[model samples]
Target: MGEYNMMITEFPPGYRFMPTDVELIEHYLTKKVHCQLPFSSLSPLFQHIDANEFYNISPDNLVKNMCVDGGEQYFFIHGDKYFGGERGKSRVVGNGIGYWRCLGEEISIYNSEGDVIGLRVNLKYFSESSSKNNWTMQKYRLTCEYDTSDTEIEEWILGRITKGKRNDYSNYF
Candidate 1:
Protein backbone atom coordinates (compact mmCIF):
# COMPACT_ATOMS: atom_id res chain seq x y z
CA MET A 1 0.00 0.00 0.00
CA GLY A 2 1.06 3.57 -0.62
CA GLU A 3 2.22 5.70 2.32
CA TYR A 4 -0.38 7.98 3.88
CA ASN A 5 0.25 11.20 5.78
CA MET A 6 -1.73 13.17 8.34
CA MET A 7 -1.68 16.77 9.47
CA ILE A 8 -1.69 17.91 13.10
CA THR A 9 -2.35 21.37 14.44
CA GLU A 10 -0.07 22.88 17.04
CA PHE A 11 -1.19 24.86 20.01
CA PRO A 12 -0.54 28.58 20.22
CA PRO A 13 2.26 29.99 22.29
CA GLY A 14 1.57 30.18 26.06
CA TYR A 15 -0.93 27.34 25.78
CA ARG A 16 0.03 24.14 27.56
CA PHE A 17 -1.25 20.84 28.82
CA MET A 18 -1.54 20.27 32.53
CA PRO A 19 -1.25 16.64 33.51
CA THR A 20 -3.33 15.24 36.34
CA ASP A 21 -1.62 13.57 39.28
CA VAL A 22 -2.87 10.17 38.16
CA GLU A 23 -1.67 10.85 34.64
CA LEU A 24 1.70 12.00 35.94
CA ILE A 25 2.03 8.93 38.16
CA GLU A 26 1.12 6.59 35.33
CA HIS A 27 3.06 8.16 32.47
CA TYR A 28 5.93 10.18 33.87
CA LEU A 29 6.64 8.58 37.25
CA THR A 30 6.25 5.01 36.03
CA LYS A 31 8.12 5.36 32.77
CA LYS A 32 11.11 7.70 32.93
CA VAL A 33 12.61 10.80 34.49
CA HIS A 34 14.16 12.81 31.66
CA CYS A 35 10.99 12.75 29.64
CA GLN A 36 10.05 16.32 28.76
CA LEU A 37 6.58 17.66 29.32
CA PRO A 38 4.99 20.38 27.19
CA PHE A 39 6.13 23.22 29.40
CA SER A 40 9.25 24.22 31.24
CA SER A 41 9.42 22.19 34.43
CA LEU A 42 11.20 22.63 37.72
CA SER A 43 14.17 20.56 38.77
CA PRO A 44 13.63 17.39 40.80
CA LEU A 45 15.29 18.86 43.85
CA PHE A 46 12.88 21.77 43.90
CA GLN A 47 9.94 19.52 43.14
CA HIS A 48 10.71 17.06 45.90
CA ILE A 49 11.73 19.64 48.43
CA ASP A 50 8.87 22.01 47.71
CA ALA A 51 6.18 19.35 48.08
CA ASN A 52 5.33 19.47 51.78
CA GLU A 53 2.05 17.62 51.56
CA PHE A 54 3.52 14.34 50.37
CA TYR A 55 5.16 13.59 53.71
CA ASN A 56 2.36 15.24 55.68
CA ILE A 57 4.92 17.66 57.08
CA SER A 58 6.43 20.95 56.08
CA PRO A 59 10.14 21.60 55.57
CA ASP A 60 10.29 23.84 58.59
CA ASN A 61 8.56 21.24 60.70
CA LEU A 62 10.86 18.55 59.35
CA VAL A 63 13.95 20.49 60.24
CA LYS A 64 12.58 21.41 63.62
CA ASN A 65 11.03 18.07 64.55
CA MET A 66 12.96 15.32 62.75
CA CYS A 67 16.54 16.54 62.30
CA VAL A 68 19.06 14.23 63.93
CA ASP A 69 20.31 16.86 66.37
CA GLY A 70 23.88 17.42 65.07
CA GLY A 71 23.66 15.00 62.11
CA GLU A 72 22.71 17.75 59.67
CA GLN A 73 26.25 18.24 58.43
CA TYR A 74 26.67 14.93 56.64
CA PHE A 75 23.12 13.84 56.06
CA PHE A 76 19.80 15.05 54.70
CA ILE A 77 16.53 13.98 56.22
CA HIS A 78 14.45 11.67 54.05
CA GLY A 79 11.35 11.10 56.11
CA ASP A 80 9.84 10.66 59.55
CA LYS A 81 7.10 8.22 60.32
CA TYR A 82 4.91 7.09 63.20
CA PHE A 83 3.33 3.82 62.24
CA GLY A 84 3.15 0.05 62.79
CA GLY A 85 3.57 0.45 66.54
CA GLU A 86 6.95 1.95 65.79
CA ARG A 87 8.25 5.43 65.24
CA GLY A 88 11.43 6.15 63.31
CA LYS A 89 13.25 8.34 60.82
CA SER A 90 15.00 7.78 57.50
CA ARG A 91 17.84 9.71 55.92
CA VAL A 92 20.47 9.57 53.21
CA VAL A 93 23.99 10.54 54.11
CA GLY A 94 26.49 12.17 51.80
CA ASN A 95 28.51 9.44 50.11
CA GLY A 96 30.09 11.75 47.53
CA ILE A 97 28.62 12.68 44.16
CA GLY A 98 27.84 9.39 42.47
CA TYR A 99 25.38 6.55 42.16
CA TRP A 100 23.82 5.32 45.39
CA ARG A 101 22.03 1.99 45.44
CA CYS A 102 18.98 1.08 47.42
CA LEU A 103 20.11 -1.76 49.66
CA GLY A 104 16.50 -2.56 50.59
CA GLU A 105 13.16 -1.11 51.62
CA GLU A 106 10.93 -1.43 54.69
CA ILE A 107 7.18 -0.84 54.71
CA SER A 108 5.08 -0.65 57.82
CA ILE A 109 1.29 -0.72 57.61
CA TYR A 110 -0.53 0.64 60.61
CA ASN A 111 -4.15 0.56 61.72
CA SER A 112 -6.05 3.41 63.37
CA GLU A 113 -4.57 2.36 66.69
CA GLY A 114 -1.05 2.69 65.22
CA ASP A 115 -0.51 -1.04 65.26
CA VAL A 116 1.16 -3.13 62.62
CA ILE A 117 -1.16 -5.23 60.55
CA GLY A 118 0.70 -6.19 57.38
CA LEU A 119 4.19 -6.17 55.97
CA ARG A 120 5.82 -7.46 52.77
CA VAL A 121 8.86 -7.31 50.53
CA ASN A 122 9.31 -4.16 48.44
CA LEU A 123 11.70 -3.93 45.48
CA LYS A 124 14.28 -1.16 45.44
CA TYR A 125 16.67 0.42 42.97
CA PHE A 126 20.12 -1.01 42.56
CA SER A 127 21.52 2.50 42.08
CA GLU A 128 20.52 6.16 41.69
CA SER A 129 22.25 9.37 40.70
CA SER A 130 23.25 11.82 43.38
CA SER A 131 25.28 15.00 43.31
CA LYS A 132 26.92 16.87 46.16
CA ASN A 133 24.10 19.40 46.04
CA ASN A 134 21.18 17.56 44.46
CA TRP A 135 19.61 14.21 43.76
CA THR A 136 19.01 13.47 40.09
CA MET A 137 18.18 10.09 38.60
CA GLN A 138 17.54 8.22 35.40
CA LYS A 139 15.44 5.65 37.21
CA TYR A 140 14.27 5.10 40.75
CA ARG A 141 11.80 2.85 42.54
CA LEU A 142 9.34 3.61 45.31
CA THR A 143 7.58 1.30 47.73
CA CYS A 144 4.42 1.85 49.71
CA GLU A 145 2.65 0.07 52.53
CA TYR A 146 -0.91 -0.95 51.90
CA ASP A 147 -3.70 -2.85 53.63
CA THR A 148 -2.76 -6.03 51.82
CA SER A 149 1.02 -5.73 51.63
CA ASP A 150 3.86 -3.52 50.56
CA THR A 151 3.57 -2.46 46.94
CA GLU A 152 6.14 -1.39 44.37
CA ILE A 153 4.22 1.72 43.63
CA GLU A 154 6.38 3.74 41.27
CA GLU A 155 9.45 3.70 39.07
CA TRP A 156 11.16 6.73 37.54
CA ILE A 157 13.23 5.82 34.53
CA LEU A 158 14.69 8.26 32.02
CA GLY A 159 14.41 8.01 28.26
CA ARG A 160 15.22 10.57 25.60
CA ILE A 161 13.12 11.63 22.67
CA THR A 162 15.60 12.63 20.08
CA LYS A 163 15.30 15.30 17.39
CA GLY A 164 15.01 12.62 14.73
CA LYS A 165 12.18 10.93 16.66
CA ARG A 166 10.41 14.29 16.92
CA ASN A 167 10.86 14.88 13.23
CA ASP A 168 9.62 11.40 12.44
CA TYR A 169 6.44 11.93 14.39
CA SER A 170 5.88 15.34 12.84
CA ASN A 171 6.44 13.99 9.34
CA TYR A 172 4.32 10.95 9.97
CA PHE A 173 1.46 13.10 11.06
Candidate 2:
Protein backbone atom coordinates (compact mmCIF):
# COMPACT_ATOMS: atom_id res chain seq x y z
CA MET A 1 0.00 0.00 0.00
CA GLY A 2 1.10 3.59 -0.59
CA GLU A 3 2.19 5.80 2.31
CA TYR A 4 -1.38 7.15 2.49
CA ASN A 5 -4.52 6.49 0.39
CA MET A 6 -7.80 8.04 -0.70
CA MET A 7 -9.26 11.56 -0.42
CA ILE A 8 -9.40 10.72 3.26
CA THR A 9 -5.65 11.47 3.29
CA GLU A 10 -6.31 15.20 3.18
CA PHE A 11 -7.02 15.14 6.87
CA PRO A 12 -4.34 14.86 9.55
CA PRO A 13 -3.60 11.58 11.34
CA GLY A 14 -5.18 12.59 14.67
CA TYR A 15 -8.40 13.44 12.93
CA ARG A 16 -11.16 10.92 13.35
CA PHE A 17 -11.07 8.30 10.62
CA MET A 18 -14.71 7.66 11.20
CA PRO A 19 -17.33 9.41 9.14
CA THR A 20 -20.63 10.82 10.34
CA ASP A 21 -23.91 9.27 9.28
CA VAL A 22 -24.55 11.90 6.64
CA GLU A 23 -21.05 11.74 5.26
CA LEU A 24 -21.25 7.96 4.92
CA ILE A 25 -24.57 8.03 3.15
CA GLU A 26 -24.04 11.12 1.03
CA HIS A 27 -20.37 11.00 0.17
CA TYR A 28 -19.33 7.38 0.12
CA LEU A 29 -22.29 5.03 -0.28
CA THR A 30 -24.35 7.17 -2.62
CA LYS A 31 -21.44 7.80 -4.94
CA LYS A 32 -20.54 4.16 -4.68
CA VAL A 33 -23.96 2.63 -5.41
CA HIS A 34 -25.15 5.17 -7.99
CA CYS A 35 -22.07 4.81 -10.23
CA GLN A 36 -20.85 8.34 -9.48
CA LEU A 37 -17.43 6.97 -8.57
CA PRO A 38 -15.50 4.32 -10.46
CA PHE A 39 -14.70 0.91 -9.02
CA SER A 40 -10.97 1.58 -9.22
CA SER A 41 -11.42 4.67 -7.12
CA LEU A 42 -13.23 2.71 -4.43
CA SER A 43 -10.86 -0.25 -4.51
CA PRO A 44 -8.13 1.52 -2.60
CA LEU A 45 -10.26 1.93 0.50
CA PHE A 46 -11.43 -1.69 0.59
CA GLN A 47 -9.95 -5.12 -0.13
CA HIS A 48 -11.76 -8.13 -1.62
CA ILE A 49 -10.49 -10.75 0.86
CA ASP A 50 -12.83 -12.50 3.22
CA ALA A 51 -12.58 -11.97 6.99
CA ASN A 52 -11.23 -15.49 7.66
CA GLU A 53 -8.25 -14.57 5.57
CA PHE A 54 -7.81 -11.82 8.17
CA TYR A 55 -6.11 -14.09 10.68
CA ASN A 56 -3.21 -14.55 8.30
CA ILE A 57 -2.66 -10.80 8.30
CA SER A 58 0.04 -9.73 10.71
CA PRO A 59 -1.07 -7.66 13.71
CA ASP A 60 1.40 -4.93 12.81
CA ASN A 61 -0.07 -4.74 9.32
CA LEU A 62 -3.53 -4.34 10.78
CA VAL A 63 -2.20 -1.80 13.30
CA LYS A 64 -0.86 0.40 10.49
CA ASN A 65 -4.36 1.74 9.80
CA MET A 66 -4.60 3.69 13.04
CA CYS A 67 -7.57 6.02 13.28
CA VAL A 68 -8.10 8.83 15.81
CA ASP A 69 -11.00 6.78 16.94
CA GLY A 70 -8.24 4.58 18.38
CA GLY A 71 -8.49 1.71 15.91
CA GLU A 72 -6.48 0.51 12.98
CA GLN A 73 -8.53 0.35 9.84
CA TYR A 74 -9.20 -2.70 7.65
CA PHE A 75 -11.56 -3.80 4.88
CA PHE A 76 -12.81 -7.16 3.65
CA ILE A 77 -15.18 -8.59 1.08
CA HIS A 78 -18.41 -9.58 2.88
CA GLY A 79 -20.02 -12.70 1.47
CA ASP A 80 -23.67 -13.76 1.14
CA LYS A 81 -23.87 -16.75 3.47
CA TYR A 82 -22.18 -18.43 6.40
CA PHE A 83 -21.90 -22.24 6.70
CA GLY A 84 -25.07 -23.10 4.78
CA GLY A 85 -28.06 -20.77 5.27
CA GLU A 86 -27.15 -17.90 7.57
CA ARG A 87 -28.96 -14.71 6.74
CA GLY A 88 -26.08 -12.29 6.15
CA LYS A 89 -22.70 -13.86 6.99
CA SER A 90 -20.36 -16.79 6.50
CA ARG A 91 -18.64 -19.05 9.03
CA VAL A 92 -15.29 -18.69 7.35
CA VAL A 93 -15.25 -14.92 7.60
CA GLY A 94 -14.16 -15.25 11.18
CA ASN A 95 -14.58 -18.96 11.89
CA GLY A 96 -11.96 -19.54 14.53
CA ILE A 97 -10.43 -16.42 16.03
CA GLY A 98 -13.56 -14.26 16.14
CA TYR A 99 -16.55 -13.06 14.20
CA TRP A 100 -17.88 -9.85 12.72
CA ARG A 101 -20.65 -9.10 15.14
CA CYS A 102 -23.20 -6.53 13.99
CA LEU A 103 -23.69 -3.63 16.40
CA GLY A 104 -26.69 -1.39 17.03
CA GLU A 105 -29.49 -0.92 14.50
CA GLU A 106 -29.02 -0.80 10.75
CA ILE A 107 -29.55 2.74 9.61
CA SER A 108 -30.97 3.50 6.19
CA ILE A 109 -28.73 5.33 3.78
CA TYR A 110 -30.86 7.68 1.74
CA ASN A 111 -30.36 9.96 -1.22
CA SER A 112 -31.75 13.48 -1.56
CA GLU A 113 -35.04 12.11 -2.88
CA GLY A 114 -35.33 10.06 0.31
CA ASP A 115 -34.80 6.87 -1.60
CA VAL A 116 -32.87 4.33 0.45
CA ILE A 117 -29.38 4.00 -0.98
CA GLY A 118 -28.08 1.30 1.34
CA LEU A 119 -27.45 0.48 5.00
CA ARG A 120 -24.66 1.30 7.40
CA VAL A 121 -23.65 -1.77 9.38
CA ASN A 122 -21.26 -1.55 12.31
CA LEU A 123 -19.45 -4.76 13.19
CA LYS A 124 -16.76 -5.72 15.65
CA TYR A 125 -14.16 -8.49 15.46
CA PHE A 126 -14.04 -10.70 18.52
CA SER A 127 -12.12 -13.79 19.56
CA GLU A 128 -13.91 -17.06 20.36
CA SER A 129 -13.64 -16.62 24.10
CA SER A 130 -15.54 -13.33 23.92
CA SER A 131 -12.81 -11.85 26.09
CA LYS A 132 -10.69 -10.77 23.16
CA ASN A 133 -11.81 -7.79 21.06
CA ASN A 134 -10.11 -6.88 17.83
CA TRP A 135 -11.44 -4.33 15.36
CA THR A 136 -14.54 -2.41 14.42
CA MET A 137 -15.79 -2.39 10.84
CA GLN A 138 -18.32 -0.11 9.29
CA LYS A 139 -19.78 -1.40 6.05
CA TYR A 140 -22.10 0.12 3.51
CA ARG A 141 -24.19 -2.11 1.29
CA LEU A 142 -26.72 -1.33 -1.42
CA THR A 143 -30.30 -1.96 -0.32
CA CYS A 144 -32.61 -4.58 -1.78
CA GLU A 145 -34.53 -1.69 -3.30
CA TYR A 146 -31.70 -1.21 -5.75
CA ASP A 147 -30.59 -4.81 -6.32
CA THR A 148 -31.75 -7.83 -4.39
CA SER A 149 -29.46 -10.33 -6.03
CA ASP A 150 -26.60 -11.88 -4.06
CA THR A 151 -24.06 -11.07 -6.77
CA GLU A 152 -24.97 -7.42 -6.69
CA ILE A 153 -24.66 -7.41 -2.91
CA GLU A 154 -21.21 -8.92 -3.17
CA GLU A 155 -20.10 -6.33 -5.69
CA TRP A 156 -21.37 -3.25 -3.89
CA ILE A 157 -19.73 -3.68 -0.49
CA LEU A 158 -17.57 -0.90 1.02
CA GLY A 159 -16.15 -1.21 4.53
CA ARG A 160 -14.10 0.86 6.96
CA ILE A 161 -12.39 -1.10 9.73
CA THR A 162 -10.67 0.40 12.75
CA LYS A 163 -8.59 -1.29 15.44
CA GLY A 164 -8.24 1.05 18.35
CA LYS A 165 -6.09 0.63 21.44
CA ARG A 166 -9.13 0.29 23.64
CA ASN A 167 -12.04 -1.92 22.73
CA ASP A 168 -14.58 0.67 23.65
CA TYR A 169 -18.24 -0.09 23.11
CA SER A 170 -19.47 3.48 23.59
CA ASN A 171 -20.47 3.77 19.96
CA TYR A 172 -22.86 0.89 20.41
CA PHE A 173 -23.82 1.37 24.03
Candidate 3:
Protein backbone atom coordinates (compact mmCIF):
# COMPACT_ATOMS: atom_id res chain seq x y z
CA MET A 1 0.00 0.00 0.00
CA GLY A 2 1.11 3.59 -0.63
CA GLU A 3 0.82 6.85 1.33
CA TYR A 4 -2.71 7.85 0.29
CA ASN A 5 -4.13 4.41 1.06
CA MET A 6 -3.92 3.91 -2.67
CA MET A 7 -2.59 0.39 -2.73
CA ILE A 8 0.42 0.34 -5.03
CA THR A 9 1.64 -3.17 -4.40
CA GLU A 10 1.41 -6.00 -6.91
CA PHE A 11 -0.99 -8.65 -5.73
CA PRO A 12 0.87 -11.21 -3.68
CA PRO A 13 -0.96 -14.23 -5.06
CA GLY A 14 -4.77 -14.19 -4.92
CA TYR A 15 -5.51 -10.67 -3.78
CA ARG A 16 -6.87 -7.90 -6.01
CA PHE A 17 -8.12 -4.36 -5.59
CA MET A 18 -11.88 -4.55 -5.72
CA PRO A 19 -13.44 -1.72 -3.80
CA THR A 20 -17.14 -1.45 -3.17
CA ASP A 21 -19.09 1.54 -4.54
CA VAL A 22 -18.79 3.47 -1.30
CA GLU A 23 -15.11 2.80 -0.98
CA LEU A 24 -14.51 3.78 -4.56
CA ILE A 25 -16.25 7.09 -3.98
CA GLU A 26 -14.94 7.89 -0.51
CA HIS A 27 -11.40 6.58 -0.79
CA TYR A 28 -10.24 6.89 -4.37
CA LEU A 29 -12.44 9.38 -6.23
CA THR A 30 -12.74 11.74 -3.28
CA LYS A 31 -9.00 12.01 -2.82
CA LYS A 32 -8.35 12.22 -6.54
CA VAL A 33 -10.88 15.02 -7.11
CA HIS A 34 -9.53 16.96 -4.15
CA CYS A 35 -5.98 16.74 -5.51
CA GLN A 36 -4.82 14.70 -2.54
CA LEU A 37 -3.52 11.77 -4.56
CA PRO A 38 -0.19 11.74 -6.31
CA PHE A 39 0.20 11.10 -10.02
CA SER A 40 3.06 8.63 -9.44
CA SER A 41 0.92 6.20 -7.43
CA LEU A 42 0.71 3.27 -9.81
CA SER A 43 -0.87 -0.03 -8.91
CA PRO A 44 -1.88 -3.10 -10.85
CA LEU A 45 -5.46 -2.17 -10.04
CA PHE A 46 -5.46 1.59 -10.56
CA GLN A 47 -3.99 3.71 -13.37
CA HIS A 48 -4.50 7.35 -14.28
CA ILE A 49 -5.17 8.41 -17.86
CA ASP A 50 -6.25 11.61 -19.53
CA ALA A 51 -9.96 11.89 -20.40
CA ASN A 52 -9.39 12.57 -24.08
CA GLU A 53 -7.01 9.66 -24.55
CA PHE A 54 -9.12 7.33 -22.50
CA TYR A 55 -12.27 8.02 -24.50
CA ASN A 56 -10.47 8.17 -27.84
CA ILE A 57 -8.43 4.96 -27.57
CA SER A 58 -9.86 1.60 -28.48
CA PRO A 59 -10.56 -0.75 -25.61
CA ASP A 60 -8.19 -3.37 -27.02
CA ASN A 61 -5.33 -0.91 -26.94
CA LEU A 62 -6.35 0.22 -23.48
CA VAL A 63 -6.11 -3.34 -22.18
CA LYS A 64 -2.48 -3.52 -23.28
CA ASN A 65 -1.81 -0.60 -20.94
CA MET A 66 -3.39 -2.37 -17.95
CA CYS A 67 -1.28 -3.92 -15.21
CA VAL A 68 -3.87 -6.39 -13.95
CA ASP A 69 -3.54 -10.00 -15.08
CA GLY A 70 -7.25 -10.39 -15.83
CA GLY A 71 -10.74 -9.22 -14.96
CA GLU A 72 -11.42 -5.54 -14.20
CA GLN A 73 -9.09 -2.58 -14.73
CA TYR A 74 -9.55 0.67 -12.79
CA PHE A 75 -8.64 4.18 -13.85
CA PHE A 76 -8.87 7.77 -12.70
CA ILE A 77 -9.93 10.09 -15.50
CA HIS A 78 -11.33 13.58 -15.81
CA GLY A 79 -15.01 13.37 -16.64
CA ASP A 80 -15.25 15.36 -19.82
CA LYS A 81 -18.34 17.43 -20.44
CA TYR A 82 -19.92 17.50 -23.88
CA PHE A 83 -19.53 20.74 -25.81
CA GLY A 84 -22.16 23.22 -24.54
CA GLY A 85 -23.94 20.50 -22.61
CA GLU A 86 -25.10 20.33 -19.03
CA ARG A 87 -23.19 18.24 -16.53
CA GLY A 88 -23.81 14.49 -16.65
CA LYS A 89 -26.38 14.82 -19.39
CA SER A 90 -24.68 13.51 -22.52
CA ARG A 91 -22.83 10.38 -23.55
CA VAL A 92 -19.11 10.70 -24.29
CA VAL A 93 -18.21 9.62 -27.80
CA GLY A 94 -14.84 8.62 -29.19
CA ASN A 95 -13.09 10.01 -32.23
CA GLY A 96 -14.12 8.03 -35.33
CA ILE A 97 -13.23 4.56 -34.00
CA GLY A 98 -15.82 3.67 -31.35
CA TYR A 99 -17.84 5.28 -28.58
CA TRP A 100 -19.24 4.59 -25.13
CA ARG A 101 -22.99 4.32 -24.77
CA CYS A 102 -24.75 4.32 -21.46
CA LEU A 103 -26.58 1.17 -20.42
CA GLY A 104 -29.32 2.84 -18.40
CA GLU A 105 -30.05 5.43 -15.71
CA GLU A 106 -27.34 6.24 -13.22
CA ILE A 107 -27.35 4.24 -9.98
CA SER A 108 -26.99 6.06 -6.70
CA ILE A 109 -24.45 5.22 -4.03
CA TYR A 110 -25.50 6.11 -0.53
CA ASN A 111 -23.58 6.40 2.71
CA SER A 112 -24.51 4.80 6.03
CA GLU A 113 -26.66 7.81 6.85
CA GLY A 114 -28.77 7.16 3.76
CA ASP A 115 -27.41 10.22 2.03
CA VAL A 116 -26.56 9.98 -1.62
CA ILE A 117 -22.86 10.45 -1.92
CA GLY A 118 -22.09 9.28 -5.42
CA LEU A 119 -23.48 7.84 -8.61
CA ARG A 120 -22.47 4.99 -10.90
CA VAL A 121 -23.11 5.15 -14.60
CA ASN A 122 -22.70 1.96 -16.56
CA LEU A 123 -21.41 2.18 -20.13
CA LYS A 124 -20.53 -0.30 -22.83
CA TYR A 125 -18.00 0.09 -25.61
CA PHE A 126 -19.02 -0.69 -29.18
CA SER A 127 -16.41 -0.95 -31.90
CA GLU A 128 -16.99 0.45 -35.36
CA SER A 129 -15.46 -2.66 -36.91
CA SER A 130 -17.59 -5.13 -34.96
CA SER A 131 -21.16 -4.82 -33.70
CA LYS A 132 -20.55 -6.56 -30.39
CA ASN A 133 -20.13 -4.77 -27.09
CA ASN A 134 -16.73 -5.93 -25.95
CA TRP A 135 -15.99 -3.58 -23.12
CA THR A 136 -17.98 -2.49 -20.05
CA MET A 137 -17.21 0.51 -17.88
CA GLN A 138 -18.69 1.75 -14.62
CA LYS A 139 -18.10 5.47 -14.17
CA TYR A 140 -18.24 6.72 -10.59
CA ARG A 141 -18.85 10.37 -9.78
CA LEU A 142 -19.29 12.22 -6.50
CA THR A 143 -22.52 14.05 -5.75
CA CYS A 144 -23.10 17.78 -5.27
CA GLU A 145 -22.21 17.58 -1.60
CA TYR A 146 -18.56 17.11 -2.54
CA ASP A 147 -18.39 19.96 -5.02
CA THR A 148 -16.68 23.24 -4.19
CA SER A 149 -17.63 25.26 -7.31
CA ASP A 150 -14.42 24.21 -9.04
CA THR A 151 -15.37 22.47 -12.25
CA GLU A 152 -11.89 21.06 -12.66
CA ILE A 153 -11.98 19.38 -9.28
CA GLU A 154 -15.43 17.97 -9.93
CA GLU A 155 -14.36 16.48 -13.25
CA TRP A 156 -12.45 13.57 -11.75
CA ILE A 157 -14.13 10.17 -11.73
CA LEU A 158 -13.16 6.55 -11.26
CA GLY A 159 -13.71 4.22 -14.18
CA ARG A 160 -13.78 0.45 -13.95
CA ILE A 161 -13.48 -1.54 -17.16
CA THR A 162 -14.38 -5.15 -17.69
CA LYS A 163 -13.95 -7.28 -20.76
CA GLY A 164 -17.55 -8.43 -20.98
CA LYS A 165 -20.52 -8.39 -18.63
CA ARG A 166 -19.44 -6.97 -15.31
CA ASN A 167 -17.48 -9.30 -13.03
CA ASP A 168 -18.59 -10.43 -9.60
CA TYR A 169 -16.97 -8.10 -7.08
CA SER A 170 -17.03 -10.88 -4.48
CA ASN A 171 -14.28 -12.67 -6.39
CA TYR A 172 -11.87 -9.78 -5.84
CA PHE A 173 -10.00 -8.67 -2.74
Top candidate on lDDT is 3
- Give one digit per residue, the lDDT tens place, for model 2 in 12-74: 654434455556656765564555656566454545555445544533345464545465443
**Candidate 2: segments with Cα more than 4 A from true spot:** 1-18, 30-45, 48-95, 129-134, 144-154, 165-173
lDDT of 3 by residue, 1-173 (tens): 46688754555886656678998988888888888777776454578877887877888888776543347888888755522112334354565677677777778899889999888887777776887766878888877664467665646778888886554667533
Q: Report the Cα lDDT for residue 50, model 1.
A: 20
Instruction: Encode model 1's per-residue lDDT on 40-146: one tens digit a residue.
Output: 23331123322123234322233343223221111111232211112222223233212223223434434456654333222111223421212211122223333
Question: Clashing pairs in model 2?
Answer: 52-93, 70-164, 71-163, 71-164, 72-163, 82-89, 82-90
Ranking by TM-score: 3, 2, 1
Arrange candidates by lDDT, descending.
Answer: 3, 2, 1
How well does model 3 score by local distance difference test? 0.72
**Model 1's TM-score against the true structure:** 0.21
Better of 2 and 3 by TM-score: 3
lDDT of model 3 at position 65: 62
Error of 1 at 74 (Å): 27
Worst 10 residues of 3 by lDDT: 82-91
Error of 3 at 162 (Å): 0.8
